[model samples]
Target: MQKKQFKEVVVEVKHVSKHYKIFGREDTVKALNDIHLANDAELQPVRRGEFVMLRGPSGGGKTSLLNLLGTIDRATEGVIELFSSPITPESSDEYLAKLRLEKIGFVFQTFNLLATMSAYENVELPMIILGKLKPEQRKKRAIELLTLVGLQDRLDHLPSELSGGEQQRVTIARALANEPEILLLDEPTGDLDTKNTVEVMDLLLDLNLKLKTTCIMVTHNPDIECYADRILYLADGVFEKQAINIEQTRLDYDKYIEYLNAQTHGTH
Candidate 1:
């Protein structure tokens, strides 16, 4: 693999930290401490194409770190830069909001789609809200995304009509509607059964390999973390471990899960 140039900064985090206020907001709990990140080693700098995983226990600050990186939430201290622009305390919220919409795609665990809307409608919702596409074009693009997620036949199906896996696929389709450079997903397959989990994992892996979309996902499932180019493990608000993909992340993820399960049950 050829080395990448350090000319551009896709995402940079410098000593970024978050502290959630406790009680009525007097005390604070540090969620992240002195976190620093950069794409200096990224070979294929799409200004957007990098897949990284964030893993930790519940409340270990994985979500907090993501929120800061995505600009949905601010850090209590330090700096964050997206596309090389410093996202400091002085950065305007409006600008950050626009950056998020224009450059980032988010996938949540709960499949945050309108219950009354069909899969197509849900997929088009972002474009409609952003007013980035015309009415007819939005419809066309929505269909395209549904087709990409293997939900072409379920375009008109409501959330209630789809199974858990199908609904999650719809959410993934909706996330890709904007053609975002950076994809932020929080526990995407959290509620899935083993089969559905595998299916969703495969879909994400396909997207990463085929599209090379930059993915930053937070997952508690060790089985899912293997699907990324790199995994960062957090403990007590600090990222303490790192793993890089040698072959395919899926194989590592499967083996890791099996190891974990065996350790849990003392079967190994």
Candidate 2:
């Protein structure tokens, strides 16, 4: 396995930390102590076109780090550089919102699709919000994205009509509606069955390779870590370590299912 070649920086945290002030609690909860991601000294930063996964035990601050990277929440201290733009605690909400709309895409465990919107509309909503395209352009882009996610035939299907996997695919398609530079996913496959989980990860890998869209995903499944170029382990609100794959590989659906079944049997 060759060392991963450090590329352009997409996300970097410089000694960042986060603190939460509970109303009744006298001491602020330190969600994240000092952390570092993008740096040349020993630790390497996430680069453009890289697939990075954050993994750790519960309350390990994976989501806290992710939130800071996503600009959904500002850090209590230090700076987060997104595409070389500094995100400080003082960064305005308006600026962050605009940045999120223009550059970042998010997909979550639950398919937060609008119940009334069909697949096409859901995919088109982002572009509409950004107002980056005309109605005809948005329509064309929506169809293209749905097709890209293998939902061309289900364009008109509502969220309720689609299966969990299909709804997730729609969510993925919608995330890419505006062609975001980076996609931040939180437990994207948490609600999925074994088969769907593998399928969604494969789809994500395909998109990552084909589109070169950097993926920063939070996942608990160690079995599928092969899909990432690098996996960062977070614990106690700090980066514990990281592992780099020889090369990203997709899981064979049959073999993956078999492995899961074996694990289940062994556990009992």
Candidate 3:
């Protein structure tokens, strides 16, 4: 197999830490401790179009790390650079918000769709917030994205009317509304079943390959690691190890189907 070469370091983390003060208590809990991504020997700098996975136990700071990367939360200490621009604790809220809107896309585990909105409207919300696209353009793009996620017929369906997987797919479409350079997913398939999980993974892989979207996903399922370019294991708020996923390079829908069949047939 040929090794993949990536150009440009899209994300950089240096000596980062996150802490939260306990309510009515004198002690503070450290969510992350001196995590450095750019200088790590095992984990290379994140590049465009790379599918990276962060796997760890609950409360191990995987979600915390994802939040920081998405710029939804600020770190207690150290620097985070996105697109070579340093994000410091002192960065203004406006700056961070604009950065997130323009460069970053996020999909959460709960599928965070608006309860009252249809799938089309939910997907169009981001573009409306960005205030750059016209009404017609927003509608067109929302349809395109929903169609891309195989929900063309369900655009008028509300969150309550859709299944869990469909709602999650709508959330994914919403995340891509701004055509972000990096996509951050926090336990995207946590609520999905085995079949739904496979479908979502296939969609993510397609997006990564076709759109060249940089994907950083936090997951606890080791089975899903087969779709990652590199897997970083986190433990106790620190990176424990890293491995290049040779399987991801050759993975496809057919291969996954074959694996499923083999497992069903009790074959290794």
Candidates in order: C-alpha RMSD to true structure: 3.6, 1.9, 2.7
Q: lDDT of all predictions, in order shown?
A: 0.80, 0.91, 0.90
Q: Against the hidden reference, what TM-scores do the models get?
A: 0.87, 0.96, 0.91
The CA lDDT at 94 in model 3 is 97
Tens digit of per-residue lDDT, candidate 2, span 99-204: 9998999999999999999999999999999997999999999999999989999999999999999999999999998899999999999999988999899999
C-alpha lDDT of residue 89 in model 2: 61
* Per-residue error (Å), model 2, residue 236: 0.8
In order of lDDT, best first, we have 2, 3, 1
Winner on lDDT between 1 and 2 is 2
A best-first ranking of the candidates according to their TM-score comes to: 2, 3, 1
Best by lDDT: 2
Superposing every Cα of model 2 onto the true structure, what RMSD results? 1.9
